[model samples]
Target: MLTNRQRNHIDVPTLTAVLVLMVLSLGVVYSASASWAYEKFGTSSRLLNSHLIKVLLGIGAMFVGMMLPYKIYQRLTKPALIAALVFLGITLVLGGEMKGATRWLHFGGMSFQPSEFAKFALLFHLCALVSTKQELMKDFKRGFIPVMIWVGLVSVFVLAQPNFSAGVMILALSIVVLYVGCARLSHLFLAAAAMLPVIAVYVLMAPYRRERIMMFLDGHSNGKPNYQLLQGIIGFGNGGLFGVGPGESRQRDFFLPESYGDFVFSIVGEEYGLIGTVLFMGLFLFIMLRGFRIAKYAQDDFGRLLALAITSTVTLYALVNASVALGILPTTGQPMPFVSYGGSSLIFSSFAIGVLLNISAFTDMHPREQKHGGQLSEAATRAAASDFGETSARPRPEGFVELSRDARPEGSVEPLNRAAGRQAGVGTVY
Candidate 1:
């Protein structure tokens, strides 16, 4: 049995934000998946049913993760990394491909994107390594070299799947974690420079990727990849300031491809409009801020690094998804955090949330100690005064109090009582 205080460890703001995203995801997935479901299963809500089932599973996973000690994750870091790598390797060998990319691993009647789990595992492992070996992190040989080699290996495997977006995400996340862990700026710059040629070659080899980049730079004329982008723009334009209404998106009627996944923002724009987008963005920003706060005040190095990695990964994904929908970046297969339709993405994101919640449990002030119903209002001076009072009241000499106070305070106006001190010093006021 869990007490209400224990359950409240789930950060209310973060949980609420995720729940809002989940509800929106369900709605958009129902709309976008309707056609596919009707065509395949003779029902419009088949995808919805599957999505609901996954949501339940995700919720269960999240609860478990929240309850588990963050220290346990530190212990499992190496194993998780190895397992993720093995899964990625298996995906390359036996994964299914769609659009010239093989990123999914299918087993039995179910399928999942291994890259998603890989991201989490990598974060976990990297956090453990960096946090545990802080002094070694500054050394190029002991610190960065090994991590870079592992990063290269991970990147190569992901690239072999031809998932450039996921590779980019992995690199971005790694860099962010390293940066937060206090890696040298020069190392980051050098790493970025090294990756340039690799990115160029990848883009040059893939004509579709090149064309997508060109289309992003120059407006689309053929209406192929541009079709969805155009619909997204229209959705925003029609939305004006407020919106049309919930579930009343004009773009979802076969105009936008992937209306529930990558382009779910457009549906949000169409139905809830500018206000909703702003609100959603605000929520995400709040999560990022809270996550950083957790990192800043973490109890240990591992907790700090874990919070940083998790927050950075989530923030990066949100940024990329938003950029794609706004036509600022080439469209990639990345899904919106909780707003996407995929089971794997949702479950993994939920798991990440669980990790964040766990961190929050340790970072936040204890509920019983909070002032004004969980508000952090205790002043340092007040706390110190209380401690001083308690210490003074304990069984000890009066001279000890004077010494302790003099040692602790930087400056004090009260003069030492010579007569009282002399009496205590002579007679021993214990």
Candidate 2:
């Protein structure tokens, strides 16, 4: 039911970049998984077929996300977060384990990753909580602690699955969001200090976790990296200037672990070369900047925070995945968002992007022309003005903030109220 006319309201560049990455995933995932899939399933097409199905489903979900009002998620936050928590708990208790960790839920003959859903649920809820409690954010107990309780709960649940990387990423992302939402830096620092001991214990409680850290610290027995990382580095090195060409990777024959999933960037590097890798990373960079553009023009505080959270999560995961492949960090099992071959990551991330595009629809930061792309139709424009009227009405995801022209200097546009100087990200919402 989606059409090009409907897409005119969304951020075309970000959406285009996402589609490009998804399309690229088809080739990259197939190349990365072909050998392993053949050896494991007696056919190379098994994983490719599954990944293609997920990609198609992800695209559909993204469109659905674009059509829905993002505020609807605000109303659904409590229930959605509760459901996420329940699913995560169920996964921890009854989920299948692999490689000494449990991170998936099995139902109706399908495997789902609850952490993927959980992190986003937590993000939405936190945005709501922060927006609603802006007046109290500076109050440690009433504001900061209450917000942090959810973060800690979700992180603890994730860590209980023995997923240190996800747990840390959730915690770090939550902190960043809170900071952007105008929480006190001192409060963030205090909380981080308090959690260090707990984090240390979590790391030390598991032999493998401790070993991975030690390996990275000790340089894996006197300046050597882990085998997987070493092989991944080799893949990049072999790529030289212009890659070995698609599907011509030497690492795909059971050399780099999770070649299609965690270390898919290696396959890209090996096959497409440094030029290809940089170009691949350039897409995420574009996404990161465009997400900020959306946030800067978001109709409300909640939309700003959500855009920030969604963008940061995807791009940070990509950065970490690339870092691990380059042997600059320990392997953390992070997938490269749209580029990785996974059902849950691709689906949830695509949907989150949809929500972001929905927010973008309310802003002027759309395609450059009214006739060609992203113009607010006259009916929609009237509706947006009505939704945010006469400096009295509250902004929604369907409308943007209108700054007082008098307060800004000549030839300059002030994004937020001058009074909200430090709380730029928290503008007009609290």
Candidate 3:
């Protein structure tokens, strides 16, 4: 049901960038999963086919997110947060365990991690709260505490699931969002400092987690190079400068566990070498840069914050996953955003990018959109700015659009459409 006009409104370059990653994901997953599939299922393409299906479903989710108006998300923020909490609770009670962690729920032959959805939902809730309560952000009790409460609750549930990585990811993301929303750095620093001991205890208290840390520090076990890390390093070393060549990775032959999942980046290094690895990383870098530009030019504060938060989450996931594969950091089981072969990470990432594209559509005729036949018009500009206030002050600023930092919330009411459709603004939250 997509029209040319709507399609044209998408940010083509960012879309192209993500599409490239998705394509590479399919290729790498096929290559990395081939041996595993054959050994486990007597067929090489079984896992590849499954990953393809997930990719297709993820594409559908992405488009759905893109077509939905960003403001409707604002209106649904509260309910969405509640739903996320409920899902997390349900996951704790009924989730399936893998590798000693209960992080996934299976229904009707499909499974996904609730933490993925919770991460995005929390992002939405935080953006709404910070944008609407900008006035109270400087106040510890009124602004900071309220937002942190939601963050703390989410973190607690995720940690209770024994998913330390996800819990910490949410906590770190919340603090970053708070800082970006103009919360006092001193408060954030103190908060982080206070949480350190708790995080430390949580890590040290877990047998597996404590062992991983010790192994990381010792860098060896029983006078042997750590099996997983050694295999990954050998994979990269085998890649040398150019690579061993596509589909030629020796590591995928059962040397590396979960090559198609957590350590897929090492497979890339083994197959494509440094050149391919650089190109692969370059694609992610492009997404990050383009995502930030979208946030910079977003129509309103909420849109900007949402875009940035999404971008940060994806990039952080990529960074952490890659670092772990390279043995630069202790393994955290975080998957590479779009490249890892998993349903939840891929689907959630696709959905987030779709929302980013929707926000970019309103960037006062961003060149990327125009390349696809969208136009920039004064009417669109005015419509985009209406949420902030009547800005007859001057012509729309060139390039990226942003709201004034000092803009205050004016008490007024107007009938505003909280969707793609235009409506008169009741009262500007700014």
Q: Clashes in each model (backbone N, CA, C under 3 Å)?
A: 0, 2, 4
The per-prediction CA RMSD against the true structure, in angstroms, equals: 11.2, 6.4, 6.1
Q: How displaced is residue 195 in candidate 1, in Å?
A: 0.9
TM-score of each prediction: 0.83, 0.86, 0.86
Which candidate ranks first by TM-score, i.e. highest? 3
For 1-430, candidate 1 gives per-residue lDDT tens digits of 2356656655678777777777767876787668757877899899888888888778877777777878888779778878888999999989998888888988898999888888898888888776555444556776787878777888888988998889988998898887666666677889999999989999889888887877787766355557778888888888878989876777877788778788888877778889988877777788888787666545566777787788877777887888788888888879878777788988988888888788777643233445666554443233344445643322322321221123322233233345653442422111
Summarize candidate 3's per-residue lDDT along 187-256 as a digit string, tens digits. 7887899899999999988877877887677876456556788798899999999999889999999999
- Candidate ranking under TM-score, highest first, comes to 3, 2, 1
Residue 101, candidate 2: C-alpha displacement in angstroms: 0.9
lDDT string, candidate 2, 261-319, tens digits:
99999999999998999999999999999998787667777888888889999899999
True-structure lDDT of candidate 3: 0.81
The lDDT, on a scale of 0 to 1, for candidate 2 is 0.82
Highest lDDT, which number? 2
The models' CA-based lDDT, in order, is 0.74, 0.82, 0.81
CA shift at 131, candidate 2, in angstroms?
1.7
